[model samples]
Target: MITKVTYLIATILSVKAFPQNIQLLSQLPSDPIEQPDSWAWGRHPKEGFGYKARNSLTLEQCIDNPETAGTVHCDGYDYSYPVELCISMPRLAPLKVCADAKFPKDFCVSNAANMVKAKGCQKFLTDMCIMDISLATSQPCADAEFPKDFCVANAVKLIKANGCQSYLTDLCTADVSLAVSSDCAGVKFPASACTSNANFAILDNCKGVEFPASFCTTSVQIALLDNCKDAKLPKEFCVNGDLRMIKAKGCSKFLGDICSQSLELANSADCLPAQKSVSVFRCTRSRDICLSQLCELKVRDKGSCPQ
Candidate 1:
């Protein structure tokens, strides 16, 4: 049942994905972004004119590196570029074309031509960056009495039966899991079911489900530590002790670092941590992500940041 697709390699540049060379794309003009939703990235920037553009730039990345990730572009849409990969960059090349042509249509579409050949490949990469940690992917997102088999699949089925576009966002975005058993807090599956999970093989069949903050509780915190353990613990955890070291995993600086790469080790955790100890695992992973971003940037934007 595994279908393989053809892919094209886009050879060029690095992976540090910079948003754009243009002032608008890179930095907002005013604080609060002056009704950010009104901007291109806004979900409802204008009445009957906005379509969730939060990670529009990321979408551009997907189009640029369809070869690396695997995907195809659909002709015609707001997206001027081809919809190639999940990690897409914003459209710059097509924007110019549309601007010069002075067409009413947005060029984000045709602009992103899929270099890769995999179906749904674009979404897979997007999930990695935007919605990477999902509870539906694993067993017992929280300690519960739910039967072992009562997994994301069942939840998907129930949700679809009820009729809904979103069914799993509640499972993975929480500061903690809410259900005591296999019951999925009434989340219904969308028409896009299997569209995400089937596409992403990395997490098996639990893609496209993003729980808010309810799933990030102490148990979830510990779970985050476990994930960090697998990825390569921060230097703080390695030195202070491993994730299970109670304190290391006890919502301490070490734990925070694992949950958020943005979070650095506290001053108390280590002085001159950079010189004292840098996480080999983190450094390597970050570099890899950085590389992916760079390559995506080069091909998608034509030597310039995606517009």
Candidate 2:
């Protein structure tokens, strides 16, 4: 009986031990073998499944046949997609219809100015349609509106063809002074070139160009001399020292002793020498008396006097 009971207990323990061994085996790490079409192969589409052949057709042909065209490349090979498809793809490049297409002569001629301005000189010069239009209209480049960069590159040609006035006017509008441009070297402008344009006159290149005496007023001289440091002004104009003295207090007293009626007389060749001689007198005595005494000394020493 004891052997029979012990065998029954031992058989029960063997059955429990078999279940625990199975549970421990289930808990251990495992690597499943991958199947050919299983999810382990990745979610990407297989080659040739979603592929589409690139349509080889001109933009004009594609535009004419939209449904048959499918996705047509507009901007060469850089951007190969339809215009409508560009909305979905924000990275798509801009269309270059004018660059790649041929338009009617009348259309390009009529819109030449606008097109050239929009495209700029660099692009306008390269575009066949725009270049043809430029040759037809002869604007912007021919007129005072020529681009500064373009003018700088072709300064000699433009100046020789249009003269310095027109070239300077264009350069002035662009805020490029001839003073800083080596291309303007040895170019002699006309005397009246900068009369109407004060901005042009103040350019360093204008210093050598003569001006009308009437234009060189005291106020204008102040501005002109400030810019044209080495300008060879007419002798009649007062020097910087004289101009300062004229502006100082009691300047009228000196003017009365000198030539009060006319500025030209005050700076004249004869008056300059007389003024220098009288300068040592300090204006304590009458200017007329001092002048007379000097005149007598000159007459006695030289045995003759100036008429």
Candidate 3:
């Protein structure tokens, strides 16, 4: 038998243990992202709360164009516009729950609405991105060629299994949009998808990255790189040869020219690796040639620097 003191300590320890069970419906964002017990991307309004107030809008308009659909009037701030459905949701990060035993069908479905409230549709997109990569590599994500609807149905199972949700809304929305617009099946994400947590940035340039909707805002470095051409590289990258080569020659001029443009690369980290990618792509030893060819393509195509 355990003593009261020992039992109490054990109970306390369990709360902070790795993969601790979470109540899917009621979990809140309080832990830091780096902590083992912290739910990844579980921070509330990870982008920041700037809206004055929420206004009612049709689901269609919101889905069709969230930015222009309606305005959110706040107390102190000017009337701000509504964001995407994914971003507008109060909480979108998935609750980290324990999967010790097989869950009943009702527990899965019944809690789905609540789970949606907690996790949003972000995870779905991430899974789709992973699936696209798997397919591109000739490694099917699953054993069978299930229909799109079948895949959609299995999405619930994915959530139940604690799978990713970064692109959930995009996946389902794409399916819905297929009948009306382009085929969603053809969408392909770059290798470094969802690397940043800038919500506005993701919506603008990093859509393929599939960050939580809350991460739609720009970062300080990204914002700074916009107006400052003389912006220096973080001290660490300056010392490294390959990385420095990318910055000094390959993307140096390109970075100065386009990194400031909102539509082009703003993240300096992204720029460095992108510039370095020319190193492996070209068959030439001449750094200038490699930089001109690869960097030009990246700038012209609006594509990610090679991974």
- Candidate topping lDDT: 2
lDDT of 1 at 253: 38
lDDT of 3 by residue, 150-207 (tens): 3455443332122324444334333333212333333443413333222223222333
| RMSD, candidate 1, Å | 35.9
Deviating ranges (above 4 Å) for candidate 2: 1-102, 109-169, 173-190, 197-199, 218-242, 245-307
CA lDDT of 70 in candidate 3?
24
Model 1 residue 144 CA deviation (Å) reads 32
Clashing pairs in 2: none
Give residue 41's error in model 2 in angstroms: 15
Model 3: residues >4 Å from true position, as ranges?
Answer: 1-153, 156-193, 196-232, 247-307
Worst 10 residues of 2 by lDDT: 42-51
Instruction: Provide the global lDDT of candidate 3 against the true structure.
Output: 0.33
**True lDDT of residue 23, candidate 1:** 18
Cα distance off (Å), candidate 2, residue 152: 15
Error of 2 at 222 (Å): 5.5
Q: TM-scores of all models?
A: 0.16, 0.34, 0.16
Tens digits of per-residue lDDT for model 1 on 1-307? Answer: 1231121111111111212321132444443412454335321222212223333334456445433232222121234333332224323322321222221112222322321112322222222211212422322122212222232335443222222123344332221232222344334333233123322111322333432222322233332433223333334433343333333332333432332242232222432333223333433344332223222322243323222
Worst 10 residues of 1 by lDDT: 7-16
